[model samples]
Target: MIDALVNGLVILMDPFRMLMLFAGVAIGITVGILPGLGGLMGMALVLPFLFGMDSYAGIAMLIGIAAAVPSADTFPSVLMGIPGSSGSQATIMDGYPLARKGQAARALSASFMASLIGGLIGAVALTALIPFARPLVLAFGSPELFMLTILGLSMVGVLSGSRPILGIIGAVAGLTLGMVGGAPVAPEYRFVFGELYLYDGFSLVILALGLFAIPEIIDLMAKGGSIAQRGPGLGGGWMEGVRDTLRNKWLVVRHSLFGVIIGAIPGMGSSIIDWLNYGYVVQTSKDRSQFGKGDIRGVIAPEAANNSREGGVLMPTLLFGVPGSSAMALFLGALLIFGIQPGPALLRDDLDLVFVIIWSLAIANVMGTVICLALSRPIARLTFVPFYFIAPVVLCIVILGAFQETRHWGDLVALLGFGLVGWLMKRIEMPRPPLLIGFILSGLAERYLWMSYNLYDWDWVYRPLVITIGALCIGLVIGGIWLKRRSAGSAATASDNDGQERLADNRAGEEAQKGAQS
Candidate 1:
């Protein structure tokens, strides 16, 4: 293993490969700084170049692009209250608050430092885990996969507030929509509704673009503003934040570890990992109450965890051929396009590629961090841009991304369809992540169950590992329900108490006024 890794490192020493690495990281930083253009879109746009290049160089560029995007994405989250990437959402809760309080530079610095450390940690983890990848891949089965999906769905509780019903409805809608193209068990068409375009049940990228990006743009236009406006005059020396980040190295380490573990688990992506880490920091810190309002550690934990998750997610992908999340699924496709099929053989036969991936991730992080740090001041001024220009450009980008998924008009129709759904879901307070997760995993779950039933003759359900995972899934679902009910009861009680207090004050004021009049 060490021999293979050393050889791989030597290969990366090529000036051309190094230059491509730097170029990818630089582009990734720019993409991350721009709202609505994320690593996935950037990679998709660049994928064509891979068709003409050496496999190593092609993969190297994509890896570099992926690594750098998260580093730059933190800037938008911290400075403009806009996520540079989906993974950076947790950073916005606290980071944006800090920026609003005139600490935009500080927030960006913390995010950059966190991304650097997290990326390095993730890269090292990928390298260390390479030897054991084969065995881990062999252990998982259909039942485990289904349980993992259920667990991922259980995170809706943490994501939604006050309207879990609406969230559940959106999730059900997504799951049903996911099933529309064909039956998972027998491959028979179901709900295509006589249209050839619906046979594939809507492209995942189109759905993602519609569900997340389009609605956000529409909402921005409806509100008549740009996120850039909120970020005005909020820039200065980021080095001070870097210094502050170094002082809190331990927090970053702990959060990175949290991210790595959560990310390693299949079905649990950065969304849950970030929120979970942020929640932990709030629970553990002395000044926990300062979290949502603007605490640096609060911002740092999520940024570190979000970046570190990329490493953790790649673990299963490189080893098992099973993706930890959607982004990794796209990466797996890229690997396949390069003639690398991920499985036990990759670990034994193509270990060099594995190491290259690891090292590339690290290099990308360093390059991306420096580039984004330098560009943050200018990017911060984007918040000052007028809404009229920003809205049209963002809408065009969203439509282009949606159209590119299948190169079909129906995808554009689907994009608009889901855009409306997204708008409605947002208005009703539905959590979007759960709906996205359901859309992603529903097909996988159904396929796995059918295989477990037919191939295993129902014995799969009785397997000890299956039983354990299933029970765990059930427990998570039950726990989610319990938390929801408990939260509702608390809110109900608070509402009642407030109403009573207001009525009492009103009566007392009336009585005093009558006495004065008499």
Candidate 2:
């Protein structure tokens, strides 16, 4: 095993292979900066060029693209309030707010640092777990997966902020939207309204861009200012961001591990890992006031998880030939093109290749982070550009992103519709994150529920993992409510103390006046 690891590293060190890896990282960064174009698109673009390339170099290039994207996508999410891809939607929660406060450099740097550390952690996990992960992967059956989806849904309460009812409404609305496509277990569709586009339901790109980006753009255009209200100077510089990540070191580790676990699950995609991490951090923190604002921790949590999941995603893809995501599916296809089958046989016969992948992922992450840090100052300056100057470009990019989802006119229609809905929700002070979370998880929940029911009837609920995860769901909800009440009670007590102090001061003044008159 040690020999294979060293050999893999040596192979990736060859000049041409290294150059291909660098090229992949550059392409990945470009794609990630454009809204909605993620690793999948980056991989697809490079696939044709790999036809007759050296197998090792080709694999290095693909791995580099995969590792770089989650890190690079942070650019749009932080600076413009746009989700560069589905994986980055959660970063907009606090990252864009930070940008508005002239902390774009801080946010961007922290995100890149967290991405670097998380990517390394994920690589370490992949290396350590590859030999022992088979049974762990098999442990999660349909019942367990359904419970996990429920666990994800339970986060809606925490994400809804001070308005639990509104949160519930938003989640339900999202579920309704997600259910519009073909039924998971049946042939019937719910809300197509006779349009063939509706038969496939809304694309995540359209939904995310409409909900987050369009509203911000509309408001910015109306408000007539740059994204950063404070102007060109970055209030918190790059070093501050690096400090913030280091300050929250344990947070980076926990969320990175969470990302890995979630990524390893076959059907769970990158869509919900960041949300889960965000919700967990909010739930566990004693001070929840800073979230959804410009809290650096918010930036850290999602960025860490977003990058780490790539390593976790490779687990099932390499071990069982089960692609965990669309990008992984592309990866599996590329493997087949190289005449390299993935599974137990590949593991036994080509362990060196597996290590090569690990090396590429780790190296790509380092390269991507260094490049992002070098570019952070210039890119972060975009926050100071006037909204009017920036709006048209952003609008064009967003529309193009949405249009590419299916290349149908309905994409534009849905983008406009959801944009209106998002604007209204923003006006009404309703939380949008819960809605996105609900939309992303609804299909998984329904599919798994049906699978569990058909396979085990009602008894699936009795499975140990199912019961365990269900307990976690209940605990999270109850704990969130309890923490909220505790925080409120503390505030009320502080207010009462202030009132009593003022009353005593007034009494003292009255006595002093009476004595002087006498």
Candidate 3:
């Protein structure tokens, strides 16, 4: 096994292969930073170039592009409060906050660092877990997946912060919106309102833009300033981000492991991993009030988990011939065209190829991180630009991204409509993360719920994992409510104590004055 890995390094280090790998990495970075165009599109674009190419070269380029994207996807997520990809939705929670505080470079640096560490850990895990990966994946059934969705839904309570009522309303609103296009379990459309665009429903890109980016842009315009309202600096600089990530090194390791396990399961993609990891971090941290407001650990947790998930994504694809994600699905097609099939047979017959892919992923992660770190400080300078100059361009970028979903006028209409709702939601101080998350998981949850119902006729409730997750879901909600009430009570107690102290001081001063007069 070690010998295979060593041979892969030797092959990857060859000058010609290294050049191809670097080119793919560059392409991946570009794809990631561009709104709505992510790893899936990147793999599709690289497919035609694989004809008659060496298997090592083709696979290296594919893995190179795949591995490099998560590193650069942080760019828009942080700098613009727009998710660079669906996977980056959670990143905007704190990453954009950091950028708004003039720490764009720091957030980007920490994200890249986390991605690098997580990617390496993921690759190592893939190598070590290949033997047991199948059983681990098969352990999860429809019931388990449904319970997972419920687990994901629990995040709304965590994210709602001090406003659980508003959060519940926001999540319910999102589920309604998510159900607009087509029914998950049936053929009925619930909220299309008779437009052709309504048939496909709102794209996730459109929702992300309208729900988050537009609101941030509107606020920037209203405030008449740069994103970094403080001043024109990158804050504590990139090294501070490095130190911040190092301080949370154990967090990176723990979440990376979780990422690998979660990623191995189908339908549990980066969306689930990123948010779940973020919620876990927030839930476990002692000092969490700073989370949505530019905390460094917020940047670390999601980035690490998402990057690590890329490795887990590959395990199922290679071992089970099941693509773990859209990008992996495209890459799976590329493998077929190249006469490579993924299965136990492939692993037995093509051990070197498997190692080569894994090694390429790790090496590309290093390359991607190095490239991002070198460019981060300069790239971070964009946040210092005045808002009026920046807003129109970003608005156009988001508009274009939204339009790409269907190339219809309706996409723009949906964008404007949702944008207004988002702006209003912000004005009311309602947290937006829970809404986005609820919308994302609602369809998935409904699908799995239906599946579980049909498969086991409610007997799935008796399953041990389902019961455990259900209990956890209940506990999660209860815990969030308890914390909210406890914190509120503590604040009230402190206020009362302060008032009593003031009254006592006033009485003492009056007595002293009377004594002096007497």
Query: Pick by TM-score: which candidate is best?
Result: 1
What TM-score fits each model?
Answer: 0.72, 0.59, 0.58
**Residue range with the least summed lDDT across 10 consecutive positions in model 3:** 486-495
Residues 1-518 of candidate 1: C-alpha lDDT, one tens digit per residue: 77877888888878889888887887677667767667765665455445546777777788888888777788778777777776777677778778877888888888889889988888887777766655665576776665555555554443454456666666677677789887878859988889999887766666666666666667667766554655455556578789878999999999888788778765454556766776677668887556666788977888888778878978867775555665665566567657786655577578898888887888888887877777666765654565667668767766776676668888789889888887777667676656765675677668777877777876677888778766765675466455445534533443354356558779999999999999
- Worst ten-residue run, lDDT, model 1? 486-495
Collision pairs in model 2: none
lDDT of 2 by residue, 199-235 (tens): 9877665776777677867876887754444333445
The RMSD of every model to the true structure, in order and in angstroms, is 7.3, 9.9, 10.6
Off by over 4 Å in 3: 131-236, 377-518
Candidate 3 on 433-480: residue-level lDDT in tens? 667666755676788899999989989999997898688778756764
Ten-residue region with minimum lDDT total, candidate 2: 489-498
lDDT of the candidates, in the order given? 0.71, 0.78, 0.75
Cα error, candidate 3, residue 407 (Å): 26
Candidate 1: which pairs clash? 228-383, 229-383
